[model samples]
Structure formats: C-alpha cells, structure tokens
Target chain A: MTVLDIPSGIPAHVDTPAPGDPRLARLSLNQRTTANWDLREAVEGAVAAGLPAIGLWREPVAEVGVDVARRIVDDAGLRVSSLCRGGFFTASDRAERTRAHEDNLRALDEAAGLGTKALVLVPGGLPAGDKDLAGARARAAEAIAALVPAAVVRGVTLGIEPMNPIYAADRGVISTLAQALDIAEQFAPHEVGVVVDTFHLWWEPGVYAQIARAGERIVSYQVCDWITPLPADSLLARGMMGDGHVDFPAFTRAVAAAGYTGDVEVEIFHADVWAAPGDQVIATMARRYVELVQPHL
Target chain B: MTVLDIPSGIPAHVDTPAPGDPRLARLSLNQRTTANWDLREAVEGAVAAGLPAIGLWREPVAEVGVDVARRIVDDAGLRVSSLCRGGFFTASDRAERTRAHEDNLRALDEAAGLGTKALVLVPGGLPAGDKDLAGARARAAEAIAALVPAAVVRGVTLGIEPMNPIYAADRGVISTLAQALDIAEQFAPHEVGVVVDTFHLWWEPGVYAQIARAGERIVSYQVCDWITPLPADSLLARGMMGDGHVDFPAFTRAVAAAGYTGDVEVEIFHADVWAAPGDQVIATMARRYVELVQPHL
Candidate 1:
C-alpha cells in the first residue's frame, strides 16, 4: 500500500479514528515514533494521518538539510512541534565541553529555522570513569545557563527534558521534574522551560505537584507509555498508550491545568515501534491519543 | 573447598583484606549478596569472614525457622543487621491488602525474632492493569501506617526503601528518598524510618539534601553499585561495590552525617555475584566496603 493509504490491517483492538478528527487537534507525531521514516516521509505520513504538527529530529533534518526539511513540513502545512534533542553537557574536558556548547548553539539555530520555539535539551550523563554525579550535574546546569542567551536570541526556549533515573548513568543526569524545574527556574520561563514526558516522570510520587508548579514553564508535553520487563535495552521499554500503566487522562489534565497550550508530541523509541509500518504506527498513536489522552486535555 | 575456606582464586584486582579488619567494623553482609547460601551458611559465613553482622531474609529464615535462624546468628556471635523485607502494600483488592498487612505483621515479628531493629519495606508497585499511581502510593502509606503500631510493639523499625524508578511498576511504588521520607515522617522516627540503598537512590538529584533531612529517621543503609547494560531482568541489575557508577565515599559520608550509626549492609543481587563462592563474595564485599565506603564513615 502507498504511504497515504491507511493500513487496512490495523489490529482489531486499535481504533482507526477518521482523518482530521477534532479530538486529535493537538496531536503531534514525533519523528522518533516512526523511526524508519525519513524526514520528508515522516512529515507526509503525519499529514496523511491528519496530525496537525510533527516533531523533528536533528539527524534526519540534517540529512535532507534543515532548510529543505523545513520546506517539506511547510509545504505539507504541518507545524514543527519541537526538535528531538540538543544537550550533552556533562563532559569533563574543557575542549569536549566547548564542542558540545557549539553543537547546542547550532541546535538552537536549527530549532528556530524549523519554526519551532522549543529545543529539547537532554542534559547528558556522567563522564566515563567519573563518579562525581554532583559535579556532572553542576556542569549540566552551567552549560544550560551558558546556552540561555543563545536560545533567547534565537527566540527558542531551551526545554530541559528530565529523563528517567534509569538513564542517569549514560543518557541524562537531570532525572526528575523537580530537578529540571530547579534548573529551568533559574531563568525566565520564556527563555528556559521543562518537557513533561509521561514515560520518564510518571513514577514520581510528587509529579502532579511538580507539573502544577511547572505552570507556563511547561514548554512541551510528550507522551508514551512505560511498559515493564524492560527489554535488555531499557531505551526500547516504552509501549503504546493504553498498553501500559500510565494514567494518561490524569497526566494530560495536570499539564492542561498547568496552562500548556501547545502540540502534544507522542515520542516512542521502542524496537517494535520502529519496525512497524510507519503509517500503522501513526494510526495507532493517533487512536491512542484520542482515547487515552484527548478528553482530559 | 569447604564453605569456610577463603577462595585463593579471587581476581588480583579485588583487594583481599585481612579477617576482622578494623576498617570493616561497621560492615554487614546482606544475605542476598550470597544468594546461594542458606540461613545457617550465611550466618556461619559472616562469622568466618570476621564480619560482625548478617542481614536476614525471611525465606531463608523461614526455611530453618526464625527461632533456629536467630539461634544460629546468636551462636555465631553475629548481629542481625536488618531483615530483608516486608511490604507489598499496593494491592487494590481488599482481601489482598489484608493478606499483605498480615504478612507484614509476621515480617515485623520475624525482624524481632532475628534481633534486627530494621525491617526493609518495599512498598509494592501497581496491581496488574492498574493506572492509578497516586492511589498505589497512598495505599502504601496507609499500609505502613497500619503496621506502625505492630512495628512499635515488636520494637522493629519499618524502613521505607525508595526503589529506583525503574522498579516503580513492579517492585516498589516509593521511588525517591524524599518520597520515602514523606511517608516515614508521619510516624515516630524509631517506629518508621527509611532505607538508603545506594543502587536504588544514587541517581536522585536531591539525594544529599534528603539524606540530611532523613537524619535520625535513617533506619538502614544498604550499599551496592549500579552497573550499565542492565541485564534483561532489571531485578538483578545490582553490582558489587566499586563495580559501577555509584560514588560510595560521598554517599557513605552523607549517611554518616545524617546520624545513621548502624551496620552498613552490602546487598548485591546480580547473577555473577550469586554464582560466585559465598566466602569469596563476603571477602570482596568487606574489602570494597573498606576501600570505597568505610573511610568516609
């Protein structure tokens, strides 16, 4: 079937919402969910799925060139929700740190070029052989502070994504919504903000309170379900909504009450998700969003 | 070789400290570290290794009977550092919750019989298909509250263990030291307190501050390293001290400064650790404790 054809073979359990369902108005298909799709195809697939916006990733955007990638999304009349990521600030070497800062600056420029105000920053993990978690965390904060000016100049907000603590060793040291807010609160809400990803923060006992406190500073709200018996690689542990334990309605309501009025991005990085037909993944994500999340929003 | 013989095959990289090393005065061997050992073997092993204490698990204790397990530790002159666990308090059904409560009361009695003041409480994860995280947590708190009087009568402290968020869905609902403190602080410090397991809590951004706040309420301090490429079974993700990313000296200092002057239990649950000779495991734990943790204390 063509990329535009809705998969007639979607499992019986999944609902195929009609295209342009009003309930899906805020839905944004993050590119990572359709891992096999190139930048153009992901954008077209999202458009075909009636998603109003698409979340871009820097790698795929760079492959086609950011300018062209922007044009493709613009041509499809789809908004760019937010850039996938831009931060690895925990390096100990001054030169490596400098390189990271420069890369993040470029990421800010790319986010601006893509017509998205949010640049998701995954403050990196500990340096190799370094056990100074506190020191690495301090460096992450300092790096974010350093980038605040560049982000503000570009009219982009540095969105601090507090990854799950499981990734604290090698992916992101910022591991909780409270910790993210601690750093983000250092600057004006418009210049720096937090990404409330349900998969990472759902386990937090104080998450709702933190979300409420996030208020207007909640720049991006990302969704995906956290399934258990985590595969050998914990990175692919996320499941489709309704297939896992997240109470999405409550989580979405908390974000809504916090005054975040923006595209709700669905970003999943599971192996099975990547292997699925991109069109089917979009259909599943859209249907899940409508059933599990939209009513609360 | 006899269980008492110190294996000469220990890798050269692992420091083999002298028996009864003064630096290991406060170290306790948690039974799970030597998963193959029975209650009697673990107690005798602790004695042979010159470790002053052993942390008991209910299963092994039950196998030999709590009274016999108590006598074994007493005869070996090894202090019972703490009991392995007691809480699975997140059941949604009334009868299951009652059974869990009854089981915990028996755990308290077991802790008392074993002569350990601390009973580590792993507040359970969500019931299958349950999406209410807050409800699970609340049930956990209520469960703890219900057991407080029984714990007081048994002179056993309920140590709330804030497991890593990775285990929040299946192992424990309590996922942060701060969250554990929120539940523990509701009762008298001696009746209900917290377990600071390095492997579970080292990733928390506010760990140090929470450690200070835990102060006299810190009932047990368990140590283990968190290694990467977590095996498929995240439950076996723990490693020996100094084997992974935890900074034990800093962590030990935080607990020491928090006024927790108790046996520091070495609780590892990795497959490699379990497969090793139990005597060698004890020796390695003692040596690592001396080099990586005891100095700080």
Candidate 2:
C-alpha cells in the first residue's frame, strides 16, 4: 500500500513488485530458521506460494531421497540457492575427516543433482575434546582444500557462512565474514566468498566493510533479525523484521549496493514462530520482508 | 586425582596454593551469571571465598542503599573491580541519550564511592526503530566522551565489555574487543580500556592478536564457556571451568603473555550451577579455577 522504499541500486521489479502476494516476490525458505518445520510442508508451501528458491539441507535431502527432493524442486520451478550445509571439517581423527570428505563428495553430488548454486557451509566448531580454535580453523581449511576439486567438478562454489561466536564452541569456528573470506580467497578466488547472514553477522565490528569487499563474490545473502537476552541453549527466539533492534534496512541495502542481486531470503528461528502455522509464519515474514526489508532493497 | 595431560607452558597452582580449603579462589561473582544472588549475599560469599574483587550491578545497589553496599565491600576487604554495567547508550531520541549521560555521572559517583577501578559498559543495541549500527556506536562513543571526565575524576575507567553478537540487539552493541579498544583510544585512552571476558570475546576472530594489541590497557578479565546452538536465549547455559570446550589455558596464556597479570575470574551462568547452594557454587569454581585455570597462568 505504501510506496515501496527499495534501496537505490535495486530494480523496482515494478512489473511484478507486489503481485498482490508478497510470497510471489520472495520465494526462498531457509530450512534451519524454524528447526521444527516439516521439510515436505516447506517444499509444498514454497510451491504453493510461487517462491523461486528453496534452500535444502543434506540431512533432509538424504532423508527425503534426492530424486524426490529434486523432482519437487524442479517441478516447482524453484532454484536451490544453496544446500543447508556442509563442512564441519575439523576433526581430531584422520578417518573421520576422510569420511567427512567422502560425505562432502556425496553432498556435492546431491547439490549438482538439485542444482543449487553453492553448498552453504558451517566449517566445524572447536574439535571434539580439544581447544585449538586456530588449529580447528586450519583443519577446516585443509578439509576445504581436500574438497575443492570435487566441488569444482560438481561446478559449485562453497559458500562459507560465518556463524556468530555464540556457536564458536560447537557449531562453526569460522565466526566472521572477513575471516571466512580470507580463508576462502586462499583456496580459490571464484570458488568461495563468505555467505553474509544478518543473524550471524549483524554484531560483527567490521560487517559493513566486509560486505562492501565481498561484492560479486557474495552470491548468497541471508536475513534473520537478532533478538536479545536469548534463552539458554538458544535454538530459537529469533525476532521477525522490525521487531528486533537489527538494522535490516541498512543491512540489506549495503550488500545490494555491493551488487548482490539475489533474493533477500527471510530466515527466522523463534520457537514462537515455528509453533505457529507455517503459512502464517511465512505470511508474516513475507509481509515484513517486503515492507521493512524491501525498503532497503 | 590423576594428572590429566595438561597442556604445557602453564604454571602449576593446583597444589592448593592457599590453605586448608581448596574452595577459595574465584576472585569475584558476576551478578548476571546468577539470578537472585543479590548484592549482600554476593559480597558475603566473596568475603568467605577470600575473593579480592566483585562485579556489582546497579539495580541491587538501588534497592539496598549504595552506601550500605559500598561499606560491605570495603569492610570485607573486597575490591569492586568493576560496576556491573551502564551504557545502553543506543537511543533514537537526543533526550534519551542526554539522560543516559546523566545516569552515567551517577554511575561514576557510585563507582567512586565503591572505589571500583572501572564501570562495565554494555553499549546500547541499535537505535530504536533505526537501522544504523555505525551510528549507534557513534552515539555510544559520544556518550562515553561526555561521561569520561567524570570517570577520570573518580579514577574509574569506563570498562567496555565487548559482549557476544547474541547480545547485539538488546544488551550491547560493542561486539568485539578490537572495536572497543579503538573506541577507548579515540575517546579517552587513559579514561577507558576494556573488560576482557573470555565468555564474550573468545570467539572474536583476531582475539589473540588483539589481546597483544590491547597490552596493558585491559582493565579486567573474565571467563565462562559457550555451548553451541547456544540457548535460544543465551543468558543462561554458561559452562564452568573444565566443563565446556573453551581453550581456557590458551586464552589466559594469551592475556598473560600480553602483559596482563590480573585475576582470572570464573563467571559462569548455568542453571545447573546456580541451582545449588551459592557457597557450593563458589567452592567448586574456586577449586576448579585453581586446578584448571591457574595452570594457564
């Protein structure tokens, strides 16, 4: 209803800007946001809503059978912008790491089959029973190096998502976009660039400069508003746009200006949001993303 | 107890360096880590544990006269290393910011009265309904500048505690140690440095290098461990010493090598740890800090 305030550099998409349904405008769904959401329902909803991209996870794809997931995605005319994740590469044992590399190869195969742009990665957290973060990072780099050739053959760039430090213990040790990008460049220039997710990165001291530096290499960007005083074991409690104090409008605007024309996907992980009807949650996010987030284009 | 293969380079303090009770180390109790462990009980526990310092909060002091709190700390020979917090400096309105400046002065008086070395700061999250993080940080700096002289007069450095990104929305905007030190240098080097808590900053990308860079400017140091997929709200779920995967030995070594000789306080916030008796919690922490943390010293 209000004039769309999409940031300066983005296209109006005026021809289909609102299309009377915000769902039609943004079609990507981040699988991890609401951990409890059913994978099948997610796919059906994306199809029903005319979303163009549906991010897939290796576990879900494997569980659902790649063919079935591939059929669903292809039939829905959805582009798999990214796979849920690959790369908990740090391991104390060589056998586990080799197994991981083989598993990653399988993941690459799955991604090629699904036709996603990049395998979104959360390079492993601190190694089990060990406390060498720098060493864990080195192990992650070595794992990435081991997998790069397979990824190249698969024709995909590995998107390294730098998670927030709150997860530095067990989630992913790569905790900054700059750190991720630096490591990414060391391996291969076009092969990697950091995946800038607002939830993981909004608080990063030099987030803006990193985004500007990312430029075309960014390729994939994710959005989730940050909420504070998070419940211990913070599996949920993410705020919807405009609710939390995150500067989403400026956040999206910066990267978009940096030339990432991909979808500004909405990713939420609030327990409240997950418990609600999926459609209702998506509807709310779609509306807000268009209203507040779209304003920054 | 059998000697676990302790990482080398750390000194041995595990032989009960103090006396009969191994339960008298953790130099202070962080109020935020324990709910309902009020100012009086906290100080009493500190005195019993032979703790030299305490991290106090404003609310408890307000409820029970500041004069009373001040006397208890001094009488017990306990130092108020740093006031719990002050610096929700992010505000959309100028009036609110000006009021924050006024509150900061009052905090300065409180710090002076308690003879605290520093006033811990949790710089405000984003401006209300605004999306400019840089701007919010600028406002925080301005507020610090306005309040620095008052802090200087009292010989209290506004100890900036760079909280984790999980707190970027509601609690603090200062998300990294390097940025905080930069802000300290810019505004008033002598008036500010930082309160380095491994809990909040361990995952910082360039932390090791920054610790060395921070040099003698680190006014305080704290520790707690992070668990992954951090609690939906991470206010709780902090791991105790030797509990979580934090490389505490390496962390303290970095700080100590950086020329810091301050106390290595264990600041935990797990529900499991706090549910037990306060005395019991302090005893375990003190014992563990000696066995585990002191080695890294």
Candidate 3:
C-alpha cells in the first residue's frame, strides 16, 4: 500500500485492539512514540490501547519517580520493553566522562527498577570543535566496556544503538550495525548487545548480513519509518509505519530471522505524530504494525 | 580553528595563487563549488585562480555545447578533472530505463570529448512509491553492467559515487564505499571505479579500510565538509573545510594512501558557499586545502 493510503491526524473512531490480540503479542509502544504523554499517562495509554508493553524514557520516569513509574506500569499490567537511553560518554574531559558514567549507572538502576533488561545507549558524538571521529569512537568503546560490570550487576543489557549517519557528528558516532556489534561482541551478550532500529539502519546495504551476525547479541528491535524531505530538525524526521519508504516487511523478517523475538518497539519521533492525540497515535501504529510489520514477524 | 575563524562572504583581497603553487597542484575546483558560474565563466574562473583543473557539470557543458566547452578548457590550459553526472537507471519502467541508458551514453561521450576519463555515476534511488531497496539496487547493478561496454568504448571510467545514506530514498541508493566497490569490482579497474567524497563518507567507520581496498579502482577524490543543523534542504548541507566536524587531514591521507594521484575536487553545495563571490570561495577552498588536507596528501 502507498503512503497516501495512511490516514493523517486522528481517525473518527479509534478502536483499541483486544488485549490478547495475537498480532500485537510482541508489539511495544516506545514512550517517544507518544512524546506528549507523561510517564503515568504513557503506561495507562499503553494499557488502554491493549498494548502488552511500553518502553520508558529516563526523563519522564524521573519526573514521576522511578518507584512510582514502576508501580504504575506494574499496576497496569504492562511490561517494560526497554529504557529510552543511557550513554553519552564520549567526553574527553575526565570530569565530564565521570559524570556521564555516574549518570549511566543511575540509568541502569532505573532500568532495573522498571524491570527491563534493555537499556538503549546512544554513544555520544564528537566532542565540541573536535574533528577526531576515531578518537570519539574509541572513547565510546572504552565507555561501553566500563559500563559492562554495572550493567551485569543490575541485570541490564546495554543496547548499543547505531544512529543514522546524519547524527554521527552531533548525536552518535556509532553509525553502523557492524560498528555496534564490534563493541557488543567484545563482551558477553547478556552484558552488552545491539539495538536494531530500522529507521537508523534501513539504508545499510549489508544490513541483513549484519542482522544475522547479531544473533543473540540483538537486545532491542525498534521500528520507525524514514520519511523524505527531512524536517528542519532532523530528529523528528521519523514517520508512522507505511507512511514512508521503509520496506517494513523485509526489515521485520530480517530481524525475526536473526532470532530476535524480543518486543518490537514502535518508536516514532515526528512532529505530527507527537502532535496527534496519544490514543490515536497508538491506534495508528497498532493498525500499521498489523498490516505492515507484524505479519512478517 | 573553529568555524568562526573561517571568513564569510567575499574576502577583501583574494589572491590567485600561481599555477605552479605546489600546494594546489592537485586541487580541482568542482563547478558546483561555484554554482553561479557558467561554463565559460567557470573555466575562466579556474584559470584566473591559477587552478590546474576544473570539474564539469553536464548542464553547463550543454549550455556552451560540449565541443565548445572542451575548447574553452583546452584553450585555458586547464584539465577536465571529471564529469559531474550520468546514471539514474534504477527506474522499473522499461522506457524510462532506456532513456537513462541513452542519456548516460551521451554523458560518456561528453566526458570523453572533455578529455576526462572519470564519469561520476550517481546510481538512482528507489523508484517512486517503491519500498524494495534490494530490488532497486539489483536494477542499478544491471544498469551499470549494461553500460560497461559503452564506457569502455568511450575510454571513460564509470566512477560510482556512493552518496550519504540520507539520500538513499531519492537521490542515490548506493550509500557505502564498500557497496560502490562491490559494483565497480565486477568490471576492469579502468572501466569502472569509485568516487571517494569526504562529505558523503566521513561518517563511515570502515572508510579508511574501504579506501585502502579501493586501491587502483579509485577514480576521483572529492572534498567537502558535512555541517550540522543541516539546512532546510539537505542538498545544501556541505560546509567549508574546517567549518564542520570532518577531519580533512585524516581523510585526505587515507585517499592519498589509496594510491590516488588524481585531482582533489572541492565540491561544496551549501547556500552560503554558493552565495559567496565565486573567486572568494575558490580562494578560501584553496587555502583550506593547503592548511588542512594538502599536508596529509
């Protein structure tokens, strides 16, 4: 189906799929997908939408207090699919690096409290005014290694997210699945792994092979569509499924073939998607998931 | 130095370094770098700036006619570094594909007449409304194979340009150096090669290794910096050297080590760079090359 077939804004009558809908058995709503919702609202929204799980972000979780956020998700009977982040440790300054490490440790604790094994780590980009890409990447690897013990102690798997290259300069230096695996493989799979986010990796020519190579090292499988005419703020360039050029069936099949049976988190970061009503956004993603991605999974 | 240190607009005194300036001996001003300059103007600009070579774009060459354009450069004692285009053959429509092939053949003839062996090929992106990336890439490979005989006859090498992934959906599907080499390697080194552009490839973790692997198959080396807060139109995201995060010294060293002895073409597409006086832009790029990239080369 073409992107034009997908509806915009809220549908007149949004139907929440049945709680036990087999199609959404492994589907998850990443909090960022509903950026307008607070921690409690996000959890309640996931439950109301009949979603089995919701991915939590540190900032929102911190606002409601980790204990309260955990209790809310538990009370709603929704699983914590993964934590939004924790890893910006490419700082060259010793003090800054220490602060990042401390922050990550706290993130791990929060992830543990949320009862999720996956803690997505966006390896920091190049330091300001620094043109040393290799140096930045080396620091990321070193930082990931340092976090392994803490991650293992908390029963959390650090999911090294390979962001799109457009963000390599200012957001994340790790820009390829192979680069992420190179570091993840250095440790036990349980201690470290990779996040396979289609939006970030769809353009990779060797993505299928890399997915296969990832095997059990795959920690989280995030889904989002890459739309063209990227927004002025590139961070919000993601589109709802079937509303962009991504071949979701092929990508989902590749991740499934890689033996990644973890929660398939739908994490969109589009300005329009954010502006839409949270329930409508959930309804659209769920419907698109069933039509475009879940069948392949 | 930071981007602030780089001068903006027209410099007060733009010196045209002598033709014998060893530091600029290998530098070629790509026509796009001076977007406003026409064929004759660009050729004369190159000569006035004491540049040894100039990269030609098809439209401008067509404006003055290839033969006339060729004579203009020849009379000015400037070499044609490479031709700007030719290759958008990923169309599924048979007629469209046929048209693309005919146009590419014409481009090959233009490159040959211009006395340049390098014909940069930007393999087209996915067909409209198509989500089949692998299918699009397969078509690109088939199209390149189909054009090989003509490229050989024209004594021109098809330099497959792997554009940054951001353009994979609409501009070019070939998004990695390895992917470009994969297609180029099937043919004789002289018949098919790859263009190594810093702006398009600086984020690749394996770029240095890929450049080394390219070896004799490397046809052209293009330079431009990737600036952040990418303009509303991503096409103009390139920055002046030292104004962005790319490490020119390392990139140029890698290309040089790859045994590339061709012109290092400066191909910026930023609005600010395009708005600046052509001579000032040329002068600035030359200075940046000498300070940041020439030493490494």
Candidate 4:
C-alpha cells in the first residue's frame, strides 16, 4: 500500500553504488514522465532505480492524501524535487478568481507537505472570449501577488513557468522568461522564482541571457528535448533528452553559473513514454540522463 | 492552364462599388489564403471582388512565368502588394548556405519581376542536427546582409517576418518583432523592414511598442486570427480573419498608428479553407475582414 513497505530491489540501470554516485544525486524524474504509476509506486520506482528524487503532481498527492504521499516518499529516502504545478490565475470573474486563489493555497500546502520548496506555476491563459492579452497578464500578476502571502507561509517558492508562445492563447500567458522575471521580481526570490524548462524556453534567442539574469531566482531546471514533426496533439511533443534540438550542455552551464544547485528534473509529457512500463521508462530515462545530460551538469 | 486566359466573372461577394471605399483599396488577399488558386485566378479573384490588390507567392508566379504573371496582374488593373517569401538562410554547411543565398537572390528577382516592392522573408530555423540557435540566428543576419545589396538593386524591400516562436525551430528563427527590428535597424528601412502579421505576432506583450518602433520600417501589415486546436501541422493552423482569438481592431489600430499605409493582406493557412472553392473562400475572407478587421482601419 505504500512505498515504505515495498522491498528495495537492485536497480536494473544505475548498477554502480548509488549513495556515492554524484550523478544519481542530481537527477529527478517528474512523476508525470511515468503517468501510469501512482504516488507510492512512483516513489518506490525512483528509489529502486537509485534516483535520489521524484518530482510530484498534485493529482497523485491528492489521491493518496498529501500526508500519506509525503510520508511514503520520506520513508523511501526520496526527496520531492518540485511540486508539479500551481498557477492558472488569469480569471476575470470574482468567483473564478476566488476559486483559483483557493486552489493555489491548497497547492502551496501540498508542496510544503511534500517538502518540495518549489511549486511550479503555469500562469493561466486568456479568460473566456477575451482578446485583451495585456489585461489577462495584469490579472495573472495580481493573482500571483495575492497567492504570495500563502505561498510564503507554506515555505513554498512559486516557480512561474514561462511557457512557449504557442500556448499563449490556451495555456499560460507568461510567454517568455523575461516576462516571468518581470512578475517574479516584484516579490522576494524565496517567495517567487522562475522555472527554467528547456522545452518551453529553448526557442528563444535571448534565453541564455535570461537564464543568467535569473541567477538566484532560478527555483528549478527542467529538461526535455524538442523534436519535430511534433505530435498532432501539441502537448505530447516533448521528446526524450537527446532525441531533440536542445543544446543541453549550454543550458546546464548557464543554470550552473546562475548558482542553482537544485535537482535537474526531467519532466516529459509524451504518450509513448507514458505507455511503457514504469521501470523500462526509468531505465531509458536514466541511461539518457547519464549519456546526454549528466556530462553537462 | 493559365489564370491569364480564364474568363473574369462577377465576384460572389463585394457587390458594392469599389473605388470610393477606403477599406476595399487597403485590402489584399495573400495568395496562400487561397492555396489552390493559380496566379492569374488570384489576381482575377481579387479584381472581381473589387479588391484593389493581391499578395503574390513566388511559386504561383513561377508557374505562370514571372513576366506573364506580371502582365496578367497588370492587365487586370490589380496591384501586386507583396511577394510571399524569400529567406531560409540559417544553414550550417557552406554548400547549403550558398544554395540558400542563391535561392534568395532568385526570390528577390522574382519579387522585382512581379512588381511587388516588398518581398517577405522568413529567416529560417536551425541547421540539421544543430542545437546552436544563437549560431543559426547569427547566420540568418549574415545571410540578410549578403542579400540586401541584391534586394536594393532589384528595388525590392526585404520584409522580414517575425513568425510565432512555435515556428522558431523548423520554419523561421526570427521569432519576435523586436528581434526583426534588431536586424532591420542595422540597414536603412527601405533595404530591410518588418512584416507585421497578426497571426504571427498577436500574443507578444510588447508588440505595440515594437510596432511603434517599426514606424516607417513596416513594409506590410498582414492579418489573420489565432484560432485554437491548432492543426497538428503547425504551418496550417493560421485561421482566417476574425475566426479566432486575435484582437484585430487593436492590431489594425497599432499598424495604422505606426504609419504603415500599406495593403492589409488577409492570409489564412487552414486545410479546410485550402480545400474550398477559391471564390467562396475569398467571399468568406472578405466578409470576415469587413466585419471584424475593417472597422479599425
């Protein structure tokens, strides 16, 4: 019923000693990469694979109850690198704004319970039928400001994600790292920070400059490759690490220089990877992480 | 087989007199919006619809022979507003770069031959297996510099399109109007300028500032809406005017304020629109333009 009760098996991959391996200590698999696994299994899978950490989604945390989920991972000696998400606060209606605020408060609590200081925030897209992007962005800033007190109380850093502009209409209105920083700068770095996801920000020519500018405000560094002939469904196009066009070495160097000693989380959202067995997926992810990304770190 | 020989029929839409209407004079339908139509037909269709201008694509012009294409539009009393495209300069290898340069030279010549003063340039994406976006962008700048002399000689203004960041990987590396201006500002506005397409730029927070920054450097003002459930093929997701989330009134006002008095070309790249009758498609586009976009102008 829990990751703590499961027997620890030798990892199929990562055959070398886990405790002493510097590479294994820095790698984290965001649980959505293995969407089929529940919270307990995800914790056990990461631990068994000799991975030091697992990034969590609120859905699984809510399903098992946050306390139980937190205890499960804690007992397995796995850290929750970052909580999956918390912001979608571009609502114009009073009731909707209140609901979003309540949800984010719960999300901050959940992140705190899991002991993951970072809570990723995908600032919501346009309000229904609204073409005023400027207005929507102002609302997002207000929502973030409103939630900051709660976030600070829970000891959670709200990591605002600057999604690719393609998602500007239907997803996040925070469309560039610079824009994220613009909002994040209003609060202290501990209260509000930036999520540097390579898949979203890699296309930007000035991304490196922004990464360096992020400096101590960089809460998390998420990696996934950008391959094309993208899936008909845009959400599933995040390819495995080395399978796409990202310059991982450059990204790692920039983040390292930015003074972020945080765990590097591989948060992929693809259908094929989700369909595979969790262990196989972890093995493949680990191998790719070692070959393609670990050297950069 | 040529649009030149096809009989000119009465347009199904735009029954009103054309000369006195400012909106009709300012409107132009980009040839790709009616992808199935040939050069002569696009010219004839615009003429029949009482539209004063048509945006020409190099392929259609080449199919009819550039001289013939020019004569056909000239005879129909329709102005060639702007040529569809010319840049794909971001190549890593010398041979490929040479090929791209040569092709762009031909494109500049074609724009000149078609009597369109502005040739739209989609400065290309990353080189094959290349993760160096900064390198690709630098190459694009160099390519533009190389091509500007030929452009000036041909009396063609290179209109660099700042495509949506979604296309930054595969189609156009120039992803922001600001970035386009950075490259364009190095040369005279006449030698290098910006193509302000609503579909490509509507999501940017600083677009209004950039548009004002463009000023006389704005060579063309193209319009299309950003609809959702984007075609799996990102290239075809460009919805017709007013069909999606873009604030056309705001976009029209911005360009007008920026002092661009050029034709407002309606350019949609949807599969359904492409599959329909060109005349019917033109009718719907014209209707949408008059209803949603024409008001601001």
Measured by DockQ, the strongest candidate is: 3
Error of 2 at B18 (Å): 4.6
Question: Can you tell me the CAPRI class of model 2?
Answer: medium
Residues B190-248, model 4: lDDT tens digits: 99999999989998879999999999999998988888867888888888765578999
Candidate 2 vs candidate 3: the lDDT winner is 3
TM-score of each: 0.95, 0.87, 0.95, 0.94
DockQ of each: 0.79, 0.60, 0.80, 0.65
lDDT (CA) for every model shown? 0.88, 0.73, 0.89, 0.85
On the 0 to 100 scale, the lDDT of residue A127 in model 4 is 82
User: Could you give candidate 4's per-residue lDDT for residues A69-131 as a string of tens digits?
Assistant: 988988998888899889888888989999989999989989988899999999988887888
Question: What is the RMSD of candidate 3?
Answer: 2.8
Ten residues in a row with the worst lDDT in model 3 chain B?
B1-10
Q: Encode model 1's per-residue lDDT on B1-297: one tens digit a residue.
A: 222212223354436667667876788999998989998888888888888988889998999898888888898999888997999989999999999999998999999988899999999999998999899999999999999999999999999999999999888999999999998888899989999999999998879999999999988899999888676789889988877899999999999999888999999988777888898788777777877888899
Candidate 3 lDDT over residue span A150-239, tens digit each: 999999999999999999999999999999999999999999999999999999888999999999999899998988777778888888
The alpha-carbon lDDT assigned to residue A86 of candidate 1 equals 96
Candidate 4, residue B196: lDDT: 96
**Alpha carbon lDDT at B232, candidate 4:** 82
